[model samples]
Target: MPDSVLVAYGTTNGSTARIAEAVAEVLRRDGLAVEARPARSVTSVTPYDAVVVGGGLYTGRWHKDARRFVRRHRRALAERPLWLFSSGPLDASASERDIPPVAGVRKAMDRLDARDHVTFGGCLEEGAKGWVARMILRSGKGGDFRDFAAVEAWASRVGAELVGEWERSR
Candidate 1:
């Protein structure tokens, strides 16, 4: 229920950034001040009332920047409300159960007392690669599986709680 939020994300091919932007848009719509930035670019979360950290899951681990962001700001984040997210799993079935597989991040979440962690379906453009991607796109396989509706819905829910918390404090 912070008046402001910082959405820090780490992305490789940029899918994670898009997801973070979508979440930021929803939070802004809810009348909360929000800033979305790449995790590596963020040096501090001092100005924000809440923090949302997310990253792309690659090879059963979160992107390094995102992990480092949490580690660097763990003390500050633990003093405020925090949330975590991971964007990966090109298929619906896989996304439903996709959680970052890192003990360090899990420990970080525990330290921050994170409010929640969500896994969202991701997009891997076949066009992003050369020949293989084109073939996949043509076959309509492994395209963008991200559900914008779901992302917005979850963001809206978080917004409601956050706004309510702010109001109560006021």
Candidate 2:
């Protein structure tokens, strides 16, 4: 049977979802069954061999839904391979440390024993954000800052790791 992965994400302006889809596509191409969706839409993680959770970053935090998802499924997630990512940097060139995953979720990541946590670049659309969000984005960053090539490289690495690990276990 093919290995299956669940890629769940939370996005306020949709950039994180796009990143999640890219990750899922790379996993699918690597011959894994992949289910990509918003965090709210996922009710369970037990059906898959592995799980990936990602979210948009805001005010140095991940969207609430993504955090809640991890909290709710903490036990189930702990039993399987779990990976995390956060997309919030408006500068595609920013290093992951400069746009780290919400520090608050470290407990959840630890409980789930996540294999990896990545910080990817994000995108901001014109006028799609509220005043606060706009103001935040305007603090010297805007436009589509997502680096598809970089995202793809990370996803490819993830895919290879998952495949190799599964094979070794089998």
Candidate 3:
């Protein structure tokens, strides 16, 4: 395994970016070199040992830039360990439903043999949304429902895996 990790994310309201930062922090604490950047900022995946892709859901789809990034770098990503995550489902309750993975992401997953895919709770600010999204948020049905503990724990696990891989490569 390589000593570098990249946490690339796409966010609209910025929640997914926070999640990506948290993951990167945990990995950094594990003594690995990690860089977190927006998906659009990543020109290539060639320099990373492993990649973690994250994006927020908008109208049941991931941000377009994220989808495009993955597609463009799918071949390079396939040669490395890859993990995918999404910020969706307003709360833990929403996780119970069988929401299909975003179509573009599903295609990427097939190509990358992604080691893991996760869906975490998302958020929508009161006035930060468009009319339709605002209406949904105003309905009292949506909330900032991220479970930071769960997010941290998952990151720790991934860090452990990266550490193991790094040691073996040595």
Candidate 4:
């Protein structure tokens, strides 16, 4: 049987969730069974052969839910093939060039031995939950900056690599 993969994300205004869903779709196309879920809602990571965790960047920090999910499932995550991602740069920078993960994410990657990390653009729209989000929208800096093409390309690479590894093992 093919391996089941989990794509979990933490999002404040829902953009990160969309990115995660896009990633999952690519992985599915690559022949892996994939599930995309909110990081906070996932009860366990034991069922998945590999994991992709993503969060929205917030004030130089990763989203709280993603951080907590990693902390809570550290042991399980460490044993799995893991990847991390952060989305938050309300501009074209992410599409233009690579953006490094934040400090906490770097530490988590090191400790968990994650295979890769990526930073995609973010979105700030009206009705976003926090005062900060509202302020950004008020300033006219809010728009959907996520590049689905880039996101799918990255995910295809990941899915290809994972599938190759699984095939070789069998």
Candidate 5:
């Protein structure tokens, strides 16, 4: 197994959590010890050698808890390698060229000095959403458009990076 890795994520309706689990699976398959947990579940960053932080987007903002987590552990995160990702942009057709960084994400990238940052498409369930979220879904503004293949590919890249880091340290 490779060095311990923490895959922490924040979700609104659970899409981000699903993405985090998928990422953790990819790392595990690559032989890394990975732990996937919600932002609130993480009491400290002292155990993990590397961290991957993810969150869902709402109104051009990441979940507040995620932002706070990063801010709280910025020092520990900076000492180790850290990556950030966001699940947003409802339109599946929009490529990376079409989607610019959301303000919150951009700010976090700077604050965390993240090694990498990515944006993934998110999911919207019309039937399961609350009034406000359902309205957003019904308005045709948000939809379930996550690209699992891309997510997997990115996870592979992360795995590669972790392996490389492990090798270098030895």
Candidate 6:
């Protein structure tokens, strides 16, 4: 029901950014104004009526930018309609089952009273940074496991809830 929404993401190698964009696209389709931006680049959350925050998980921790963003804007974020998401898990488990938020993200969700949280399959491919990524690629364990259909499906649900809330408020 918010006229404006912010989809902010923290991504390493850009996979999480794409996921954030997909969420923004769905929200826009549902007749809301949405902007998707990197979490580090977002200076404030005050301009938006609602917010969706996402981070790429690394060693069970949310990206630093995401963690900082939440900490920096905790008060504003807590006052708004907020949702959280994580992008990680190189396997299909995220799509197959409910992947709970990592401890840090879970704490943030609780502190902010976020409406919901979801985890999506992560993408790891050629040209990824870090030795671990290289090792994974060399070991032939890397692939694009991101399911856009599933992403869209989840976004549709979020959009519906927001739209429904807006209609009722009117």
Best-matching candidate per TM-score: 4
lDDT score of residue 24 within candidate 5: 94
Preferred candidate (lDDT higher): 4 or 6: 4
RMSD of each: 3.3, 2.0, 2.0, 0.9, 1.8, 1.0
Per-residue lDDT of model 6, residues 1-170, tens digit only:
68799999999899999999999999999899999999999999999999999999877889888999999999999999899999889999998999999999999999999999999989889999888778988998888878889888888888898899989989
Give per-residue lDDT, candidate 1, residue 47.
90
After superposition of all CA atoms, the RMSD between model 6 and the true structure is: 1.0
lDDT of 2 by residue, 1-70 (tens): 3368999998888889999999999989998999998999998888888899998888788888899999
lDDT of each: 0.82, 0.83, 0.84, 0.94, 0.84, 0.92
Kindly list the per-residue Cα lDDT of model 3 for residues 97-133, writing each as its tens digit: 4345677778788888988877788877776546767
TM-score of 1: 0.85
Q: Which candidate is the best by lDDT?
A: 4
In model 6, the runs with Cα more than 4 Å from the true position are none
Cα lDDT of candidate 2 equals 0.83
lDDT of 1 by residue, 31-112 (tens): 9999999999998899999888888776567878999899888899988888888877767854465455356567777888
After aligning candidate 3 to the native by TM-score, how far in Å is the CA of 142 from where it should be? Answer: 2.6
Runs of candidate 5 exceeding 4 Å displacement: 93-98
- Whole-model alpha-carbon lDDT for candidate 4: 0.94
Q: Which wins on TM-score, candidate 1 or candidate 5?
A: 5
Clashes of each: 1, 0, 0, 0, 0, 1
| TM-score of candidate 6 versus the correct structure, residues matched by position | 0.96
Clash pairs for candidate 3: none
